[model samples]
Target: SQKTNIKALLASDAIGSTVTVRGWVRTKRESKNVAFIALNDGSTIHNLQVVADTAKFDENTLRNVTTGACICAVGLLVESAGSGQRVEIQAESIEIYGVSDPEKYPLQPKEHSLEFLREIAHLRPRTNTFGAILRIRHALAYAIHKYFNDNGFYYLHSPIITGADAEGAGEMFRVTTLDAKNPPLDETGSVDFKQDFFGRKTNLTVSGQLQGELGAMALSKVYTFGPTFRAENSNTARHLAEFWMIEPEVAFNDLDDNMELAEDFLKYLINYALTHCADDLAFLDARFRKEEDKKKKEERAELGLLDRLNFVVANPFERLTYTEAVEILIKSKPAQKKQFQYEVNWGTDLQSEHERYLVEKHFKKPVILTNYPTHIKAFYMKQNEDGKTVRAMDVLFPGIGEIIGGSQREENYEKLMARVKEVGIHEEEIWWYLETRKYGTAPHAGFGLGFERLVLFVTGMGNIRDVIPFPRTPQNADF
Candidate 1:
């Protein structure tokens, strides 16, 4: 018989059928006459109870079936007598594929902290918490693709290595083939990038927005979902050396259209998770509550995970301008009481604390803040008629402040070139991007959603590193 996945088996009613199930043992409980083995194959969060008669299997083989052991059990499918699950396997034959020594194996049948799990990330997927997170991650990825395909969006593959800095952050991981010890230098005594692999200076792309814009100019509507890199030295829970970004660009769309699209897209994704990943979400919700319970009374969340998600999906996000948000923040209790870490000002960027106050305390719902100061926003954002603000928008969630950030791109060629020069970027660097405005440039807008941040919010995982597999951080790249 072919091997049946545990997820399919649990949802089916094939009673009295002999079947084969392959998985690693989660736990083994033995009695005088029978042994109950909880087995999981990383399908669903639940485990299948395999009843093995002690008399039917060799003692040595059973001894090897400890926790984390890989095994194949041929059994008869029957209704489970247990309380938690509906169906179970009655093992008629057992085969041990791999043995895990209980004394040395890192993962035991107990609760392990997230910090410890990071140390052994290679085997952390076997844990229920990580398994549920990974499953939800897959579901969210699928929902993103499905939603885009259904809404007439083409997935554009942007280049991994780029010459122009999209965000103008100047924090990029250098991509070069020059020798670090003794490399080529020009007459100016500077490292010559002309001798590099690409024959010019290049680095891992920081954002696909610029390349994605090129696609949108021709394709009318396009999105790029790919990995991006940064070389920042921060080791915060929210920061990562490598991350994935989802950027959607549309021609002839203004700031209002961009806001509408972001709101609808986010709602669809959250609702999709609530519908298709109910089981995993339930597990994560329970876990989220437990973690929240450990915090101080004042620091605890106002709503549970499921409640927060439901609220965001059911209601509309509050919309306001950056000026309004700053005014509100300055008058808020946190600001008046001097509790905020950073001061709220008109021209300065809003910090995470300020954003959370607007979403969690002020609006009490998701918010879409628009019309940010031009000095605080990117050069590509359309300059407002006021000459102080740009048509930029940031979608803020309850726990996560800014889940999405975008703007209406500057369509006027003269204005764009002026901003480019004002930001100290040479015209030769992004000549192609500048040309898009010169020739038949229609109003275009787009936003970027950090794929890891979305996963972190959906899975209710606190740390950004926990959501992505094999997290790349400063000085830590171990598998």
Candidate 2:
């Protein structure tokens, strides 16, 4: 058993106290008779330094113990009066437990590209940046659960496979047990597999919103947090083939109520990440600490500095309606003319460029755009009194556009059925959803939040692939 708590001991007045610690060596420095090595046990980002006599231990062992080798050391906790850090452990005896092969290991002390890191997904967690990202990921997940639980929302598990395409966009990745090489054929040239999966064809679910709505009809309020797949062919920073989605549906609620819920929920998550994951956040902040380091030195010399971490943690997101946002974009026509891929039309679905401009330049903060054209949106959206637009909204952040997409659902069966059919999907597939309105439908609303996009926004991470553990993209499943 190790004799001391590395965290407490390093943080205490107990300098030069006997202790023992086991961790993988990050790096080592050696001189004629003395040596210093940094050790990390995944306890925190800061490494504990162990000082030892190079002449005392086995010479061959010391030389062979390259980077990434696991070792145990009996040492003394001493104040690091020399420099670098507060305090570290001074060693008397060293023991090697595991040997990491030098030639085969991919990661070294130097920087590695994101593309290369994806190739070594399993080993990437050992890096400080990924470790911090994952820790924040856990904190964010817990915050989601905590916020919903405290607010009287039931956590509901929805199915992974469904017969209906809920989003009305056929981006589902099909699932089948039938042979791809030799599929059952009808007299027609096309393959007819009605005899698959007990009868009708099914595919991986694109969203749990429909099933979640069922739970809301029965229980008044429900939220589903699980994996959703998309077969989108575009190789962009914003799209992922398979990622997690958070859907919260409510009964007796309108679009206004839904918008309020989304804003509050997002604020709660950002607050949680900043509060609960301090060490992780610090580690993340440290990666961008060059400016901070320069500022600290300049402080004594009498100068001003920009506190980036403070700004991120305390910043309040701005909000705007869809029509208002469009007006702002139209005014910022210069930025749009050169940058946007598509023209910024008034009633058309807001392109990613328009969304980014509203949040990143015009508002200078996150903006929630509400009330989009019904024809440009999904069939389930509630129609506005204007006779053209729907009660749809998207939450756009500074760096990422449309992190969340949600709205008020059509509670009236007649209107909903009409829209569903007009959109050209088989109404029989969502017969149960339509029947919810028939039984005793009340006003209901909800939203779908992309989990990876949120992570990217919070971390200032440039790529969606960096936010997820093992990204599943088109023709590239490296893991």
lDDT of each: 0.91, 0.80
* lDDT by residue (tens digit), candidate 1, 1-479: 64789999999889989989999999999999999999999999999999999999899988999999999999899999889999999999999999999988999899999999999999999999999999988888898899999999999999999898899889899888999999899999999889999999999999999989999999999999999998989897777899988899999999999999999999999899999889999999999999999999977889999998998889989999999998998888743438788877899999988898888877899999999999888899999999999999999887777889999999999999889999899788899999998788899999999888899888888999899989999999999
lDDT of 2 by residue, 361-424 (tens): 6765667778888888999999988988889988887667889999899998889988988999
Candidate 1 TM-score to native: 0.98
Candidate 1: segments with Cα more than 4 A from true spot: 334-336
Question: lDDT for model 2, on a 0 to 1 scale?
Answer: 0.80
Residue 336 accuracy (lDDT) in model 2: 54
How many backbone clashes can be found in candidate 2?
2
RMSD of 1: 1.0
User: Against the true structure, whose lDDT is highest?
Assistant: 1
